[model samples]
Every structure is written in C-alpha cells, then in structure tokens.
Target chain A: AQTVTQSQPEMSVQEAETVTLSCTYDTSENNYYLFWYKQPPSRQMILVIRQEAYKQQNATENRFSVNFQKAAKSFSLKISDSQLGDTAMYFCALQKAAGNKLTFGGGTRVLVKP
Target chain B: DAGVTQSPTHLIKTRGQHVTLRCSPISGHKSVSWYQQVLGQGPQFIFQYYEKEERGRGNFPDRFSARQFPNYSSELNVNALLLGDSALYLCASGYRWGEETQYFGPGTRLLVL
Candidate 1:
C-alpha cells in the first residue's frame, strides 16, 4: 500500500520570500517517483516538480525545488520568491515504478501575501 | 502540441442520476488516467487506461466505470450519483503508464444535488 501525508493544512508567505511544505510517504515498492501538484482557484491540477527516488540529488525547476530524503521518506517542496499567483492548494503524490496509480496527500493551502 | 482536454467543464446531477465525463488526451499520448478531487482534498485515483485496455483501478465502487477509445480518448461514467460523488474530475495523459509524468486537463466539475 502507498500512503502520503501532508502535515500542514495551510501556510502563508510574503512576496519574494520562501515557504516550504512538508510531506512524508510510505510505499512498498523499492523504486518510485514523487510529485508536487498545484491547484489554484482555477481547479486545474498543474505539475510543479517531480523527483525520482533513485536520484541522490534533489530536483529543482525554476523557483520550485524539492528536498527528497529517501531514507526518511520525506519529500518537501520549497517555493522561493513567492508571488501572489502562488496562492493555491498543493498536493504531494507518489507513484510506483511498476504501477500506474498515484496516491496523494491531503493537500496544503498556500496563501501568498503581496 | 495541445495538452489534455476534458469536456463539459461543469455539470449538475441529482441523486440516482447518471453522469458521463469525457477526456481527450494529448496528441500521440497512449495512456489516460482518471481521478476524483473532492473539495479541499487531494485527487483520488479512479481508473487508468493504456492502449485501450484497463491498466489499473482504484478503490471506487462499481457505480464508477470508464472506457478508452482507439483514439486514446476516454469517458468516465458514474451511476446512481450521491451528494458525496460531487467533485472535480481530472483526466491526465502520459506517453505510457508507469514512471511517466502525467499531464492533467483543466478538469470537469460535477455537482451532485
């Protein structure tokens, strides 16, 4: 079974600052992938960033990056230089290396203050 | 070049009613997956199709069903809808299935009355 947990229900950050959302997941598979998806008021699930479990280095894209601790089963997302548009619901997801299903967390709502 | 697309951007149905949501995958993509996102929660996987075959199914009941067409388009059917069934239906497409970074559509919002 695969389970994901996002402890924070909500988070706030000022513009140009940084905010980190925490997530912990458990999966039986040895190889898998982790992802962060953002859902704004538009209700569309947009892919933010993803990391392969086997990769030792964390994955970063533009201002979005992840701190992936394989041993601890932690994958946290860091949004730097936050903008007002960054306000949204962020979800952490996990997919197995040999499976198609993606198990997701309870999501964290982020509010970016201008 | 177009991304995944879903039809009937919004819908409303009463209890015991049936609803069908459609999805069109990106060009050349072969896999499509369905998810249900209730308000203030994360999306829950429903179904996945690859090469017009059922690849995976989630914990949903028999009231939920889906099918994929030869063109890689898909439809999600929900019968005997209940208030709890109301949610945002998301469709994602990827090159294949496992380990693929799926791209999602705008989603279909269904309100069960």
Candidate 2:
C-alpha cells in the first residue's frame, strides 16, 4: 500500500514571507499524482496544487507551488507571501491510476503570523 | 459550481444504532467518494462510486456501505455503530473515478454515544 509522510508537524511563517511544507511518499507505480490540500478549521478540504508523476515541471497555483521530485518521491508545497488566511492544516495526498481515493499525510499545521 | 454538499451538518447516534449520511456531487461531476476523518488524523477513504457503480472499496469493514444514485448523489450507511465510528464524514466529487482532483464538502460530524 502507498503511504504519504509529512515530516513537519507544525510550522509558522510571517505575513508576506514564504514557507515550505515537506512531504514524501512511497509508491511503486510510475503513474501517480501528488497533491496539497488545505483544510481549514471549518473542516472543508480545498485543493491547493497537484503534480503529475510524469511531469518534470512542478505545478503552481497562484501563491501556491509544488516542488515535485519524481525520483525522490518527494512532493513539497511552497506558500509564497503567506497571508493570515493560510493558517490551517495542510495535508499531502497521493493518488494512483487504480483509484481516486487519496492517501493523506498526517498534516502540517501552518500558522501565518500577522 | 456548488462543489459538493453533504446533509445533516452534524449527527449523533448510540452504539448499536445505524446512521445514514447523504451527499450531492458537483453539477458536472459523475463520481462521488466517502471518507472518515477522526480528530487529529487524516481522512481515510471509505468508498468510491463512479457512473453509479462501485469503483473502489477501502479497508473499512462491512459495517460501512455506500451507493451512488442515478443523479450522481450518494449515501453512506453504517450499521451497529461503534464509538470508533464517531468522526467527520466527508464527501468528495470528481469528474471521474481517477481524475486526481476531488472537490470536497463541508463534511458531517458524527458523534456516537
């Protein structure tokens, strides 16, 4: 079974600064997908960014970008110019071609300071 | 789009009772999935349905069952509820079963006594 690992349990970043949350996964499948999801206190999960295993270029979504290393099986999320609204639990998830179910990491609590 | 919508923002049941949770997928989405999120843990996949057919089944037991309707809406039913079943039930929808991106609903909090 594939599993996602988020090494950082908690992280803080000052307003307008940049912060990165680390995530790694183990998968034997060559074709897969990595994702970053922002889960606010309301328990609503929102997609931040996604990276395809075959793509060498990282995925970027507005202020959110992904550092995807296929060989290393590492997919990290970088939040630039962090805002107060970024304060939430960030989860790293992985999906394969077999199913759409996401295997999520434990999550990293990001606190954007004012 | 409305993303995904789940019914009964909150639910409470006793151990040995049964519970049902409903969900509506996005307007153009044809797939729906169910997940359980316990406090301080990540959401675990329960079931996945696409085109009104069961596409994936997670490691959950027989106590957890779900089905999709013709309209792409879905319902998850849990029988003989245990306190361990108490968690946040989340519904996510996608264009297809393995589309990679899933839009999630606000989730229904289930509490078992």
Candidate 3:
C-alpha cells in the first residue's frame, strides 16, 4: 500500500513570487511515479508535473517544478512567478510502476494574492 | 482533439437512490479511471479499466461499481447512496495503462440529500 502526506493544509503566496508545497509518501515498492495535480474551482484535476522514483533529476515544467528526494521519500512542488490563476488546491499523488491506482495526499489549498 | 468528457455536470439524489455517471475518454485512449473527491479533500481512486476490462480497484465498498465500453467510455454506478456519498466524481483517461500520465475530465458534481 502507498500513503501520501501533505503537511500544510493551506498556503498563501504573492503574485510573481515563488511558493513551495511539501509532500511525503511511503511505499514498499521501489518503482513508482509521483505527480502534482492542480484543481481549480472548476474541479478539474490538471496535471502540473510528475517525477519518476528511479530518476535522480527533478522534473520541471514551465513555472512548475518538483524537488524529489528518493531516500527521504519526499516530493515537493515549487511554483515560480505565481499568477492569480495559480490559486487552487494542489494534490500530490503516487502510482506504482506496475499498478493502475493512484494514491493521493489530502491536498494543500493555495491562494495567490495580488 | 477533445479531452476527456463526463456527463451530467451536476446531479441531486436522495438517500437510498442510485446514480450512474458517464465518462467518455479522449479519442484512441483505451484506459479510463474513476475517482471521488469530497469537498476539502483530495480525490480517491475508485476503479481503473483498460480495454474494457477491470485493471484495478481501490478500497471503496461494493456499493461503488464501474465498467468500460468498447469505445473506451465508462460509467460509475453507486447503489443505495448515502448523504456522505456526495462528492465530485472525476474521470481520467490515459493512452495506455501503468506509468503513463492520466488526463482528467471536468468532473460530475453529485449532491445527496
């Protein structure tokens, strides 16, 4: 079984600034994938970034990036140059390499203030 | 091309009622997954289907069930709904199964009274 944890329930960031959200997961399997999804008021689960457990390099996409630590079992997301549209609920998810289910963290609500 | 689509953007049901939600995956996608997201919480996996076959299931009770069609569309059925069963139902689709990225639809909002 895989379990994900997000320590912060909410976060606030100024527009154009940067904010990082922390996530930690526990799983017995060595091979798996981690993802960050953004859900706006519309309730659409939008993919932000993903990191492979076996990969040493962190994953980055546009203004979104992840700090992945394999030994620590930590995967954190960093949003740079945050915009008003960045305000949303962020979720960290885990999927095993051979499994189809995605276990998710509770989530963190982010508010980007102008 | 169009992304994943789900039917009945919003619904209202009473206790003991049954509701069926529909989802159409992206074109050519063969895998569809279902999730339930209660307000203020992250989405929880319910079921995953590939090639019209059950690939995986979550810890949900037997009250929740799902199936996929040949066209890769899927439906989630809930029996004897309870007020606690109210949630936003999400449908996600992937090009294949396994480690591939899954794309999600807007989701269906269900409210149980």
Candidate 4:
C-alpha cells in the first residue's frame, strides 16, 4: 500500500510572499503520478498541479511549483506571490501507473494574509 | 458546461439508517468517483466507475457502495450506516481513465447522529 504524508498540518504566508507545503510518500512502483489539490471554504476540490514520476523536470503552473525528489519520494508544493484567494487546504496525492485511484496525504491548511 | 454536481448538498442520518447520495458528471464525461472526507482530513477514495462499470474501489467497508448509470451519473448508497460515516461525501468526474484532472462537486455533507 502507498502512503502519503504531509508533515506540516498548517502554514501561513503573507501576500506577495512564498509558502511551501511538505509531502512524502512510500511506494514500491517506479512509475506513478503525483498531484496537488486545493479545497477552499466552498468545499470544492480543485486540481492545482501534477507531476509524472518519469518526468525529471518539476511541474509548475503559474505561481505554483513542485519540488519532486523521486528517489526520496518527496513532492512538495510551493506557492509564490501568494494571494488571499490562495488560502485553502492543500493535499498531496499519488497514483500508480496501473491505477486510477489516488491515495492522498492528510492535508495542509494554508492561510494567506493580506 | 456545468461542472460535476453532487446532490442533497447536506444530509442527516441516524445509526443503522440507509442513505443515498447522487452525482452528475460533467457533460461528455464517462467516469465518476466517490470519496469520503472526514473533518480535518483529506478525502479518501471510495469508489470509481467508468463507462457504467466498476473500475476501482477503496478500503471502505461494504456499507459504502456506489454505481454509475449509462448517462454517466452516479449514486452512492450506504446501509446500516454508523456514526463513523459522518463526513463530507464528495463526487468527482473525469473524462479519461482517472488520470485526467478530476473535477469535484460541492460534496454532500452527511452527518450520522
């Protein structure tokens, strides 16, 4: 079974600053996928970004980027130039090459202060 | 044009009761998945159905069951529910095998008393 861990239960960042959420996983499969999801007060889960295990280059989308260390099974999310709208609960997830189901980390609550 | 939608929005149930929650996927999408999100925790996979067939299931007990219709809509059923079932039950949809970005609904909040 694969398990994802998000050590930081909560984080806070000021507007225009940066915040990083930690994530680590245990997996025996070499090929898989990682993702970051955001759930705001509206309770809607939204996809933030994703990284393929085979892709050495980190994935970035606008102000969001991931530091993926394949060997250490670490995938952390970094939010730059944070805005108040960026406040949400971030989750890290893993999916094996042969599986469509995702195993998610506990969660990290990020608060962006204006 | 609308995104994934889950119905009931909120529910209240007593122990040993049976509850049904509904979900409608985005247009043209043939995959629907269900998840259970407890307070202060991440969502946990419950069931995934594609093309009206069961594709995958999570570690949830048999009390948690779901099905997808030919129209790509879905319903989750829980029988003999327990207080532990109190949580926000979310439904997500994707066009591809589940690898595609999943669009989630506003989840049905279930409170088992």
Candidate 5:
C-alpha cells in the first residue's frame, strides 16, 4: 500500500513571502501522480498543483509550484507571494496509474500572517 | 458551472442507526467517489463509482456502502453507525475513474452519538 507523509503539522508564513510544505511517500509503482490539495476554513477542498512521476520538470500553477524528487520519494509544495487567503490545511496525495483511490498525507496547517 | 454538490450539509444520528448521504456530480461527469474525513486527518476514500457501476472500494467495513445513479448522482449509506463514524463526508466527481482531476464538494458533516 502507498502512504504519504507530511512531517510538518503546522507552518506559518508572512504575507508576500514564500512557504514550503514537505511531503514524502512510499510507493513501488514506477508511474504515479502526486497532488497537493488545499482546504480552507470553509472546508472546501481545492486542488493546488499536481506532478506526474514521469515528468522531470516541476509543475507550476500561478503562485503554487511543486518540487518533485521521484528518486527521493519527495514531493513538496511551494506557495509564493503568500496571501491571507492561503491560510488553510494542505494535504499531499498520491495515486498510482492503475489505482482508483488516492492515498493522502496527514496534512500541514498553514497560516499566512499579515 | 456548479461544482459537486452534496445534500444535508449537516446530520446527526445515534448508534445502531442508519444514515444516507446524497451527492450530485457536476454536469456531464460520470465518476463519483466518496470519502470520509475525520477531524484532524485527511480524507479517506470510501468508494468509487463510474457509470453507475462500482469500480473500487476502500478498506471500510461492510457497514459503509454506496451506489451511483444513471444521472451520475450518488448516495452513501452507513448502517449501525458508531461514534467513530462521525466525520465530514465528501463527494468528488471526475470525468472518468482515475482519469483526471477530481473536484470535491463542500462535504456533509455527520455526527453520531
């Protein structure tokens, strides 16, 4: 079974600064997908960014980007120009090519302080 | 377009009771998945349905069951509920099973006493 781990339980970043949430996973599958999801106080889960294991280049979405190291089994999410709206719980998830379900990390709580 | 929508934003039930949660996927979506998110934890997959057929199921016990309708809507049924069953139930929809990104609904918060 594949499992995702987020070591940091809580993180804080000043407005306009950058924050990085670390994530690691254990998977034997050669091809898989890594995703970062954000859930605000409203409890709405939103996809932040996604990275395909086969892609060497990291995925970037607006101010959100990912540092994916397949060999190290690490996939970290970087939020740049952090705004107050970024305050939420971030989760790292993994899904194999042939799998229908996603394995999610424990999650990291981020607070963007102004 | 509206995103995934779930019914009964909140619910309360007792042990040995049964609860049914409904979800309406985004228009044109054929895949619906159910997840349970306990407090302080990430969402855990419960079931996945595609084209009104059961495609996958998680490690949940038989007490948790779900089915999809021809309209792509879905319902999650839980019987003999335990206090441990109290959590936020989320419904997600995608273009196809394990094909693209899945959009989640606001979720229905279930409280079992």
Candidate 6:
C-alpha cells in the first residue's frame, strides 16, 4: 500500500511571495504519477500540477510548480507570486501506472496574507 | 463545458438507513469514480466504473456499492449507514480509465446521525 505524508498541517505566505508545501510518499512502483490538488473553501478540488516519475523535469502550471525527487520519495509544491486565491487546502496524491485510485496526503492548509 | 456534477448537495440520514448519491460525469467522459472525504482527511477511493462496468474498488465494505449507467452517470449506494459514514462524497471523471487527470466535482456532503 502507498501512503502520502504532508508534514506541515498549516502554512502561510504573504501576497506576491512564494511558499512551498512538502510531501513524501512510500511506493515501490517504479513508474507512477504525483499530483498536487487544491481544495478551496468552496469545497471544489482542483488539480494544481502533476509530475510523472519517468520525467526528470518538474511540472509547472502558471504559478504552480513541483519539486519532484523520486529517489527521496519527495514531491513538493511551490506557488510563486502567490495571491489570495491560492489560499486553500493542498493535497499531494500518488497513483501507480497500473491503478486508477489515488493515495492522498493529509493536506496542508495555506493562507495567503495580503 | 460543465465539469462533473453531483446531486443533492447535502443529505442527512440515520443509522441503519440507506442513502444513494448520484453523479453526472463530463460529456463524452466514460470513466466515473467515487470517493469519500472525511473531515480533516484526504478523499478515499470507493469505486471506479468505466463504460458501465466496474473497473476498480477500494477497501470499503460490502455495505457500500456503486454502478455506472450507459450515459456515463453513476450512483453510489450505502446501506446500514453508520455515523462514521458521514462525510463529503466526491465524484470524479476522466476521459478514460487510465487517464492521468481526474476532474473532481463539488461533492455531496452526507451527514449520518
């Protein structure tokens, strides 16, 4: 079974600054996918960014990027030029190539301060 | 295009009761999946249906079941509900069974007393 861990339960970043949310996972699969999802107060879960294990380059989506370290089993999300809209609960997820189910981390609550 | 849509934004039930949650996937999407998100916890996979066929199931007990329709819509049924069952039920859809991205719906909040 794969497990994802988000050590920080809460985080805050000033507007226009950057913040990084840490994530780690345990999985034996060599090929898989890592994803960061944002759930706002509206209760809608949105995909932030995704990284493929076989791809060395990190995934970037607008102001959202990921730092994926496969050997360390770490996948962290970085939000640059953060805005108030970035405030939400961020979750790290893992899915193996052979499976459709996603294993998610506890989540990190981020607050962007103006 | 509209995203995944779930019915009954909120529902309340009692122990030993039953509840049925519905979901309509994005147009042209053939894969629909169900998840339960307990307060303060990440969403847990419940079931996955592709092309009206059961493709995957999680560790949930037999009390929980789900099925997909030909239109790619789905329903999740829970029987003998327990208080522990009270949570946000989320529905997700993908273009295919193994597609990388699974778009999530707003979710139906279920409360069991």
What shift in Å separates residue A60 of candidate 2 from its native position after superposition? 0.8
Q: lDDT by residue for model 1 over B1-113, one digit each (tens)?
A: 88999999999999999999999999999999999999888999999999999999999999999999999999999999999999999999998878899989999999999
TM-score of chain B of 3: 0.98
Better of 1 and 4 by DockQ: 1
The CAPRI classification for model 5 reads as medium
Q: Report the candidate with higher DockQ, 2 versus 5.
A: 2
Give the alpha carbon lDDT tens digit for every residue of B20-110 in model 4. 9999999998888899999999889999998999999999999888988889999999999999999999998888784576778999999
lDDT for each residue of candidate 5 in B22-45, tens digit (9 for 90 to 100): 999999999898999999999999
Least accurate 10 contiguous residues by lDDT in model 4 chain B: B94-103
Q: Model 4 over residues A1-114: C-alpha lDDT tens digits?
A: 999999999999999999999999999998899999999988889999999999999999999999999998999999999999999999999988775678899999999999
Name every residue pair that clashes in candidate 6: none
In each prediction, how many residue pairs overlap at the backbone (N, C-alpha, C within less than 3 A)?
0, 0, 0, 0, 0, 0
Q: Report the Cα interface RMSD of each model, rounded to 1 decimal.
A: 0.9, 1.1, 0.9, 1.5, 1.3, 1.2
Cα displacement (Å) at residue A42, model 5? 0.8
Best prediction by DockQ:
1
Candidate 2 Cα errors over 4 Å, as ranges: none
Please report, in order, the local distance difference test score of every candidate based on alpha carbons.
0.95, 0.93, 0.94, 0.92, 0.93, 0.93
Clashes of 6: 0
lDDT of 1 by residue, A36-101 (tens): 999999988899999999999999999999999999999999999999999999999999987667
Ten-residue segment with the worst summed lDDT in candidate 6 chain A?
A95-104
Model 5 misplacement above 4 A = none
Fnat of each candidate: 0.81, 0.75, 0.79, 0.58, 0.62, 0.60
lDDT value, residue B67 of candidate 4: 89
Q: DockQ for all models, in order? A: 0.84, 0.78, 0.84, 0.67, 0.72, 0.73
Candidate 3 structure quality by residue, lDDT tens digits, B17-91: 999999999999999999999999888999999999999888899999999988889999999999999999999
lDDT at residue B50 of model 1 (Cα atoms): 95
